[model samples]
Target: AQSVTQLDSQVPVFEEAPVELRCNYSSSVSVYLFWYVQYPNQGLQLLLKYLSGSTLVKGINGFEAEFNKSQTSFHLRKPSVHISDTAEYFCAVSAAGNKLTFGGGTRVLVKP
Candidate 1:
């Protein structure tokens, strides 16, 4: 079984500033991790994922995440944020052939 937790419930950042969204997971078996973003009044969009090789994974919109086995974490980061980046982010984990487990979600508020 696998479970995901988002360390922060909300993150406030200024435009052009860097932002990091912390995510941790617990699992006994091999797992796949994913980050998703949900814009206001919109469905979730895939931001990044870590399924196999390479500790660093890059996603759309200039976002990236590094998967750490020792820490059991997959934290997302963006060098610079924009007002359009304001949204809810979710961390998810899934063991092979198992259903995905999602975190509560963290809301990112970008200030102008």
Candidate 2:
């Protein structure tokens, strides 16, 4: 299957703590990576991506990940998080369709 998989659908953490949501994908010929975050009642915003080069890629809001070609995985990580970080995060892939094939989704709850 040409789809990305998010292992954790939800992660709860207190404010100023660290968190990580697992993500994996089926190997592909060519792949473009992306992570979008939907905060509260907001739409999805691009967090980061690994289009090419450099296994490690950084994105907005203190987030980053490494594109592991061998493992076919790209997991998001944040050293320290804030309450405002609470939101629904989606890992997506686009191999052919203009539309993105999103993972189930993961909700990051950063409580005070």
Candidate 3:
């Protein structure tokens, strides 16, 4: 079984500031990591993913994450955030032939 944990429930940051959202997962088998964002009243959209190849993966909206296999962590980061970036972020893990297990979610509030 695989599970994801988001250390923070909410992250408040000023606009144009850097932000990082912590995510950790546990799985017995090898798994793929992903980050998704949900805007207000909107469905989730894929932000980034780490299936193979480079440990550092970049995604849309200037977001990026590093897959640390040993630590079982895939934390999301943005060098400079914007007010439009305010949304709910979710981390997920999926193994071969298995469904994705998502984290509780972290709400990012970017204030102007």
Candidate 4:
């Protein structure tokens, strides 16, 4: 079995500021890590993923995450953020073809 933990429920940052959303997972078997963003009143979109290979993976919208196998963590980061980046971010994990286990979610609030 696998589970995800998002340490923060909400993160507030000023526009153009840097931010990092924490995400950790626990599983006995190998799993894939993913970061998804959902804008207000919109569906979730894939931000980045770590299926295999390099521990450092980059994704859309200048987002990147490092997969630490030993730590069992995949934290998403961005050099700078925009007001439009305000949304709910979810961290998910899946083993093979199994269903995904998602975190509680982190809501990013970008202010002017």
Q: Write the per-residue lDDT of candidate 1 for residues 25-80, one digit (tens) a residue.
A: 99999999999999999998999889999999999999999999999999999999
Query: Model 4 compared with the native: what TM-score?
Result: 0.97
The residue-level lDDT of candidate 2 at 99 comes to 55
Clashes of each: 0, 0, 0, 0
RMSD to the true structure for each prediction, in A, is 0.7, 1.5, 0.7, 0.7
Q: How far out, in Å, is residue 10 in model 3? A: 0.2
- Better structure of 2 and 3 per lDDT: 3
Write the residue-wise lDDT of candidate 3 on 1-112 in tens digits. 7889999999999999999999999988889999999999999999999999999999998999999988989999999999999999999999874798899999999999
State the C-alpha lDDT per candidate. Answer: 0.95, 0.86, 0.95, 0.95
What root-mean-square deviation over C-alphas does model 3 reach? Answer: 0.7
Model 2, position 52, has a per-residue lDDT of 82
Q: Any idea what lDDT model 4 has?
A: 0.95
The regions of model 2 sitting more than 4 angstroms off are 96-99
**Residue 71 Cα positional deviation in candidate 3, in Å, after optimal superposition:** 0.9
- Regions of candidate 4 where Cα sits further than 4 Å from its true position: none
Q: Whole-model lDDT for model 3 versus the true structure?
A: 0.95
For candidate 2, the 10 contiguous residues with the lowest summed lDDT are 93-102
For lDDT, candidate 1 versus 2, the one ahead is 1
Positional deviation of 31 in candidate 4, in angstroms?
0.7
